[model samples]
Target chain A: MSTLSERILGAPHGNYVDRKVDRAYVCDGTGMLTLETWKRMGAARLSDASRLHVFFDHIVPANNSTTATLQHELREFACNSSLTLSDIGGGICHQVMSEGIVLPGEVVVGADSHSCTSGAFGAFSTGVGATDMAAIWLTGETWFRVPDSIAIHLSGSLRGGAEAKDLALSYVNRLWMDGGTYCALEFIGEGVKTLQMDERLTLCNMAVETGAKTGMFYADDITVQYLAAKGQTVRPQVPETCTYIRNLELDLGDIVPVVAVPHRVDTIKPVQDLAGLPLDQVFVGTCTNGRYSDLVRFAKIVKGRKVAVRTIIVPASRQVLSEAVRTGILADLVDAGCTIGTPGCGPCLGAHMGVLGEGEVCLSTANRNFRNRMGVGGEIYLSSVATAAASSLTGEITEPEVA
Target chain B: MMQGIGHAVCLGQDIDTDLVIAGRYLRTKDHSQWVAHVFEDLDTSIAPRLKGAVIVAGKNFGCGSSREQAAIALREAGVVAVIAPTFARIFFRNAINIGLPAIECNITCTEGQKIRFNLADGWVEAEGKQYPIRPLSPRMQEILAAGGLVNYWKARS
Candidate 1:
């Protein structure tokens, strides 16, 4: 009667347990800080360089000399330490790791809040700050106060144009921000089997929005299949019993296309309610919805139709970009009046490539909608790739047409 | 006895890390830039008042992003401590890892009101009342005493 975290941490809930890391990573944003902290600890070499990774996603291409210089230093460090480096166009750290790099039952840590995204693979993954990541790199281990678990049971299947992003928003709306603070959201039930690997990743990506330590599914057939397709053979690691602090249920059929309004991710409303609300732009990409399937969905919805708004589409990784290009999805999107950006985090954090102008409104497929996140004085409304494509057609928030 | 005394600088619930220090300013490692822009989004005038201030806010403080720079900014800006009903787990850990005290206590405080806290005793005294706080574990206390995790580890090694 223990949660996945408890089992992985090898302790009961609330007990501080020190565990070895199977994998750890940091992006450009946190990499420098982590490196600095690692050096400040007077350590010269990584405890295990093979298990660590460095990804360049955020502010890729270097926004200015300051970032360029820092990224340069990080590249040198990665080279010196013999660490795996995913340079520009490598995609987001979460997405890159999910490409069979992360396995079930592993203790994975990242230096970004969305590191919880890996929990979709049934790994006991969580995010930490730069210093904590440094500690992990130095010692190849870290401490965790085993988080209590919350059981989120899903029933029925998503319908009526509802994508995994909407289900994610629905749960976040129900849990509210911080409702799952210091807790693990264990997503279980038959509905988990209905979602594809992309959808599961999307659902787990926003786990941190609810303040969860992680949102995970047990490694079942679906997890096995996903990894198998990625060229891995693994046994399912389903638990016999989980002692949860509380149980919540969501019917996927009830999930409608929803958007998290500006300044807050939990402030959700149906797409129909906000329909016809004008937007300055529409963005489709991030660690959350920037996978190949999401791009394919956006292309299918907008095929042969011109976008009324300035639409920006970014592939989450170089591999995703290759798939989109090979499938003609990229061409279809370009023909549909959407501009394609480099395969990385594009203006998700308001860095570059498509930063929203002051006072502008954007319906984005990214995870966050916080104030000034996309640009100073700009407002971000987060929605599904389907809704983003539909909204791009009208230059306003629009409900996706049911397929 | 780890203690701090400062005037309260109150904020509302769900103070996100972006609001504490926006993503745009994170490209540089300049601590002063972060200090200058700390909470600049929430209130442009608040940064000047952060020095020696105790931030009393609603539940779920530091609710978004895992940017340790947010905690670094607050600490560099001279914030003595942050008191809230609850905190996003990562931010709380970041604050502690950086030697900034993050206290969980629902103490009603008005702006500029003198607030004092005793981490060892696990209580916050504000406006003629005392609120008990959840004490940090002995390990965390030891880390804080050494100024931060790096220093703590440095001393140990």
Candidate 2:
């Protein structure tokens, strides 16, 4: 009986002893530039270009001349190397990978911290930097120490307006932001079966905020269905016996809509506890909670209400944006006075579009409320898309009513 | 062999890459420009203090984001080494690949405290106290010795 990490690690390199991985991914943010620079600096040529995935979703549509030039260089590299490129507005790398590239039981690595979002499909996915990516690009292999495992057993189902974002916040609150550092969080229990695929992605996405190497779930029927819908077939694997350094049990029924206060991800409080806090802005997107389903949830809450505060909605991918447009989700949101931005990272990376002003408060669905995340001196409150939508109407922090 | 002795510039836990250097500064791949903005969010004065200093941070230092520029910024800013209980995997690997020495030790130290770090000896000394540090892997040691991953690979080629 091996842990999920061990199985994936072993599968890739024939055994977990070597921990050498084959697949590596990169995004437009720093990765493309770094790779190009490294190549000029005499790094070896890319080994098996097919294994490397590249995307230009961080600052899609080119926020400035520098970003535009960087994207142009990445485009040329992708074309020269014959690598698959998710061009500007195609979507985020994690979302693109989950939709097409990533498969169950594979060891997936990306050059973005949110690469853990692929763990929703049971892959051993984690983030790495440009230097490591450059090395992997040249050699088709990189090292891993085979992190220890932490078991988080969730029971029951979320009620009382609680969502996966709330569950993630509660876990971060319990685990502390850095409690899972160097450890892989293995999420299991009855509640696991109850979550939607997107919900599970949300849970795994924020695992990095807890400092976990990666967060993974058992690949079950839902995972297979998800992959099948994406035109891929996968036979999910479940580890029979696994060792957990620390085991924690959480009841989903016990969770309520919660928000992570500014300066740190773990500083959480119930949404009701912080209700009526004035909000200057509300953002409803990011790789963390920006999917079609997330947009649907946000639209449902903001359908007929005019936002009292400045609200920005960014779909995670071009596919999500198209779907929202087709389903009239975008229309509903737009009619509700929500400003829709391009399908890139938007203000989540603080790169461009909807940056916060000094001393302003923003209710956002994006992960990581660290200081200066949206902007310096701007306070960020992280919550579910539903909460963000509800708060946008009231111009304060408020939890949406459960249907 | 890599060795450095300098005063400690202490930082708290989860000192993320964004805090080290924001994404807004990453558009240009200029190392010098990035170094000037190191720790700009935490303390404007800390950037000047980083020169010839060893950063001593709590657990999970260099968490968040996979930008190698965080490590590059520190190295270019004249930071000799970074000592912390633990580091995010990406940052740890980047630091080593870029020839920046990162030591893992759970010893306590205050800002401005004199400390000595020796990679070959695998130990860090401060306040008349010494703590054993884990040595880097042979592959990593070779890379650092050659001044960076590109140099190591170039030398081998």
lDDT on C-alpha atoms for all candidate structures: 0.92, 0.85
> Number of the top candidate by DockQ?
1
| True-vs-predicted CA distance for residue A289, candidate 1, Å | 0.2
In model 2, the clashing pairs are: none
Candidate number achieving the greatest lDDT relative to the actual structure: 1
* Residue B30 lDDT in candidate 1: 75
TM-score of each: 0.99, 0.96
Q: Which stretches of candidate 2 lie over 4 Å from their true place?
A: A11-22, A40-44
The DockQ assigned to candidate 1 is 0.85
> Candidate 2 residues A1-403, lDDT tens each?
6778877776421132444555678888856655764585575477788888888888878988888887788889888888778788888888778775788878888888888888888988999878777777777777776778889999999997999999999998999878888778999998899998899999999998888879999899999998899899888676676678899899999999999998788999999999999999999888888899999998898898799999999888999999999989899999999999888788997888888889999899999887897888888999998788889999999978887
Clashing pairs in 1: none
Per residue, candidate 1 scores C-alpha lDDT tens digits across A160-184 of 9999999999999989998899999
